[model samples]
Target: MSFLQLLIIAIVQGVTEFLPISSSGHLILIPKLMDFPDQGPLIDVAVHVGTLAAIVSYFWRDVWGLARGGFASVGIGTAPAERRLFWYIMAGTVPAVLVGLFLKTGGYLEGFRSTTLVAINLIVYGVLLGIADRFGAQRKSFEELTLKDAVIVGLAQALALIPGTSRSGVTMTAARFLGYSRFESARFSFLLSIPAIAGAGLLAVLDLADASARMQSDAITAGALTFVAAILTMVFLMNFLKRASMMVFVVYRVAMGVALLLFFA
Candidate 1:
């Protein structure tokens, strides 16, 4: 890929990955719309690493707490609340991992890559997010998270395996419906992405053993650019949620979905 194409891909992946907008949907549409070459598994893995680093950096405190809690759960420390939160995150990741594996192994993942499906899901889930945000209670804090709620959110996240269902969007929607504030909801969603993104990057890496030197160089550049963009985006989103509703994202998703459908039609 040319530098311009690489730059655009990194920006798109970084910006959309954490937003309610669907990164996978946008990535799928990029080549189709712009006639750029497909960025293969190497790029995918690189971008995943970038976004994963962004999440980790943005949530370092929570990550550290989870680490201590995880060790403590096995009798090493004394972080009861942290231990509970750690397990809750683990519980929330199971459904998505299983469903993703099933889709990959069955060769069913590619079937959902069409723009039409992405467009439909964009509008559908966008509206659902709007509805949940507008009507659901938002008094609960992150500390109030429970196992049942985590599982429910996990199940919602599995739906994001579809092209435009948006892992972050669906998880936030589930949390909204369960009465979490928008900020807390987004926090949990982002934290839950750790294992999911790492698993995906590892799987993508399995296909990279034979990557050429040039490809490896490109991957590193892509990863670095994506990391920069992703960290900035994460900071913006976290701060935005502190004082704003999700209606802007809802409007954006709906508008983009409608435009895609019209253009494709």
Candidate 2:
């Protein structure tokens, strides 16, 4: 891929990573449509690493609070709110990790390369998010989010490994389904992504470690660009999603899905 191609992919990575669209699905489809060979490890890692950085930077305060709470939980200094939140995040993260492992290790999500499946998943999940948001009880806040609820939300996040199933989409959908207000749902979804995305990025890094020698290739350049794009994308979405309707994302996913089907097939 040329610098331009990498830049384009980076933009896709950034925008989709947080906007309730499927970054992986777009990455796959873009290459297929352009007849580019399978994207390389460098690009994937770069964009994700960038995203990781973005998330950490954006939520440093929350992350710090969580970390402090975690440490305090073992001592006598922790506030009840901090202790509760720390445990809740851990509770939520477990199901997400387990689900991700089951799907990845069990071959349930091996269809990431299939554009048709991705397109279908995108439209279906997008619709689900919209519907869930519309009908959600919208009564809960992050403070009120329960461990039981967190685990279920995490389970929903696990499904995001499938291309077209946005991690944020599913998490927020689950939150809304369980009665979170839009802001609360969106906030928790982003919070939930911190651990899941971190784990995924770490896994990707480990996988890429075996290929670091090729980091000088064009693909690496593409990956760096993608990373920059991913960072900016996360920043924009986290800010914009404060009041954005889930329907807006749904339309984009459906349109993109149709486009993928028409053009890639």
Candidate 3:
């Protein structure tokens, strides 16, 4: 890919990956609209790595805590909040993993990338997020998270297998609906993403191996740029959610969805 193409792809992947906008949807639409060549497997893997690195870097403290807590909990038992949170993240990942495995095995996920389906989901889930944010009790924080919360959020994440459903968006919506505060809801969502993103990257790596995919000439440059963009976007989004509601994202999703439908229709 050209430098300009990489720049655009990096920006879209970085922003939408965390902003409650669908990264997969944007990646599909933007390239089509701009008439760019297919990004191919190497670029896909690079961007995935970039976003994964961003999330991991941003949440390193939590990642460390989870690692230590998980190991210790295996022996002494999981009694501390950090240890419990570790387990909670694991619990939250199960539903999505199971659902993703099923979809992959059945070759169902690729077909769901239809523009019409993406447009419909964009509007539908946008409204769902708005409703949850507007009416949710907003009384809970990360410290107060429970097993039930994780499972419900995890189940919601399963729906995100569909293009435009947005893994972050659905999980945050579920967390909000379960009464978590906006920032804390987002925190949990981001934390939950670590395993999910890692799993996805691993799958992509295996696919690359199977296909004997070769890296683009500028793959390193593209990956580095994407990583920088993703990290900045991740930081900005986490801070933004701390003070704002999901209303802006809701409006954006709905508007984009409508535009997409009109254009495609």
Candidate 4:
């Protein structure tokens, strides 16, 4: 990929990864629309690693707590709230990991990357998110999350394996429907993503074990660039949700989906 292509991938992935928009959908569309060479799974892994790092950095406190809690659950210490949350996250991650492994090994994942499929999902799931945000109660906080809530959101996240379903979007939509506030919803979604992204990246790395040096260099560069963009995006988004609704993202998703449908038609 050229510098411009790399930059565009970084910006798009970084900006859309945490938002209620689908980064994978945009990444898939860009190469098809612009006739750019596919950056391949290596670059995909690189950008994912970058965003993973960003979320981890931004939520280091939560990560640390989760770590301690994880240990505690195994009888190392006692952190009731943290231990509960740690287990909840583990339980939540199960559905997606199982589904992803099935799709990957079955060679069925790539078939869902069609632009029409992406467009439909973008519109449908976006509207679902809008409805959840508009009508769902918002009285719950992060600490109030239940095991049922985490499992439900995790199942919803499994749907994001399809292009344009938007992992963050679906998880947040689920959280909202469960009556959590936007900030708390987004926080849980972001935290849930740590394991998801890491799992995906590990799979991709297995494919790149024999990649060329130049490809490795490009991956490193893309990762660094995406890390910068992703962290900034994470900061902006967390703060923005504190005082705003997600209607703007809903509108954008609908408009973009409509445009893609028309263009593809």
Candidate 5:
């Protein structure tokens, strides 16, 4: 692919990966809309790794806590708060991984990339997110999250396997419905993303081992660009949601879905 293709792909992947907007949806539609060539296996691996790096970097303290907490939780009879959070993240990650594996094995994941399907999900899930945000209790913090909350959110995340059903968006929506504040919902969503993104990237990396030298070089360049973009976007989004409602994202999704229906469908 060309430099422009790499740049656009990197920006889209990095930004949308953390945002409530579906990264998969954008990755699917952007290329079709721009008539860009397919982003091969190497670039796919690069983008996933880059975004993964950004999230891990931004949340290093939490990541470290999760790591330590994981060890503690495994050995101890009952986990402390840190260890509990660690297990919660792990628990929250399971449903998505299982669903992803099933979809990949069935060859159904790629087939869901249709513009019409994405458009419907964008609109429907956008409204669902809005309803959850508006009516949700919004009283709880991350510390208040329970095992039930984490599992329910994980189950909601499984739905995100469908195109336009953003992993972050669905998880946050579920959290909101369970009474978590916007910032807390976002915090858990980002933290939960660690395993989910890493798992997906690891699978892609196995496929990328056979890439050409040129493709590998391009992947490195794209990875660097995506890493920078992901960091900036993650920082901005986390802080933005602290005070703002999720209506902005909801409106954007609906508008984009309508546009896709009009033009692409």
Candidate 6:
């Protein structure tokens, strides 16, 4: 890819990664529709690491608390908010990590055509989201999230491996359905993403090492650019998420899905 393509891909990765629209889905569908190579496995990891840095920077306070809480829970130290949420985030991540391992290595996420399935899921999930908010306007905040709810949300997150299911969207939707407020649901979704994305990125690093023996310097540089883009995306999404309406994202997802379907057809 040219520097311009690298920059554009990074920007798109950063923005769409946080949006309710599926980032991974976009990585697949956008390339096919626009006639570009699907970004390589190593690049996926690199971009994820960039996003991880962004989330950690933005939510350092929460990260500290979760760390303190996680430590304390193990009888090491004391931090209050750190207790359940720390563990809950960990619990929520387990299913996705497991599923990701199997699918990533088992060839489950291959075939560019799966993006069509993703687009379909995006449309269907968008409708479900509207119905969910209409009927399940939650008054409870993230503070009220239970271990059970966290686990369920995590499971929903695991299903986001499907092209258009969207990790953030699915997790937020599930949280809302379980009685969490929109802001809380959104916050928790982002929080949960930290570990999941980080884990994925770490895996990519290993793959990149092997690829480095065969891949050119330019490929590595491109991946670095993608990583930078992911970081910017995480920053923009987290802040905008605080104020953006679900309606906007819902409309976008539906429109993107429809566009993909038509274009592919």
Best prediction by TM-score: 4
The C-alpha lDDT values of all candidates are 0.90, 0.76, 0.83, 0.91, 0.86, 0.75
Better of 4 and 6 by lDDT: 4
**TM-scores of the candidates in the order shown:** 0.96, 0.87, 0.92, 0.97, 0.94, 0.89
Backbone collisions counted per model: 0, 3, 0, 0, 0, 3
Summarize candidate 6's per-residue lDDT along 1-265 as a digit string, tens digits. Answer: 5566556666666777777777777766656766777666566556656666767777788788888888899899877677988888899999999999899888876753376797798898887776665566668776776889889999999988777887888888898888777777877888999888888877776776677554445445655665566666666665674676578888888998898788777
Error of 6 at 19 (Å): 0.9
Superposition error at 25 for model 4 (Å): 0.5
Ranked by lDDT from best down, the candidates are 4, 1, 5, 3, 2, 6
> What is candidate 4's lDDT per residue for 1-265, written digit by digit as tens?
7888999999889999999899889988989998999887679778988999999999999999999989999999899999999999988999999999999899897798689999999999999999999999989987887899889999998999998999999999999999999999999999998898999888767766778888877888888899999999999999999999999999999999999999999
Tens-place lDDT per residue, model 2, 72-166, is: 89995767787788888888888778877777687665456798889898889988988997788867888787889888898898787777788
Question: For residues 115-222, what per-residue lDDT tens digits would candidate 3 score against the true structure?
Answer: 888898899999999999999987999778789998899899889888798878988999999999888888888888878878877887666555532354455556
Q: Residue-wise lDDT of candidate 1 within 1-265, one digit each (tens)?
A: 7888878989998999899999889988989999998786568668878899999998999899989889998999899999999999899999999998999899898798799999999999999999999998989887788999989999998999997988889999999999999999999898888998889888866756668877877887888899999999999998999999999999999999999999999
Candidate 1 is scored at a TM of 0.96
Model 6, position 50: C-alpha lDDT score: 64
Clashing residue pairs found in predicted model 2:
10-226, 14-230, 43-223
- For candidate 6, what's the RMSD? 2.4
Candidate achieving higher TM-score, 3 or 4 = 4
Give the C-alpha lDDT of model 3: 0.83
Candidates' RMSD to native? 1.3, 2.6, 2.1, 1.1, 1.8, 2.4
Cα misplacement distance, residue 112 of candidate 3 (Å) = 1.6
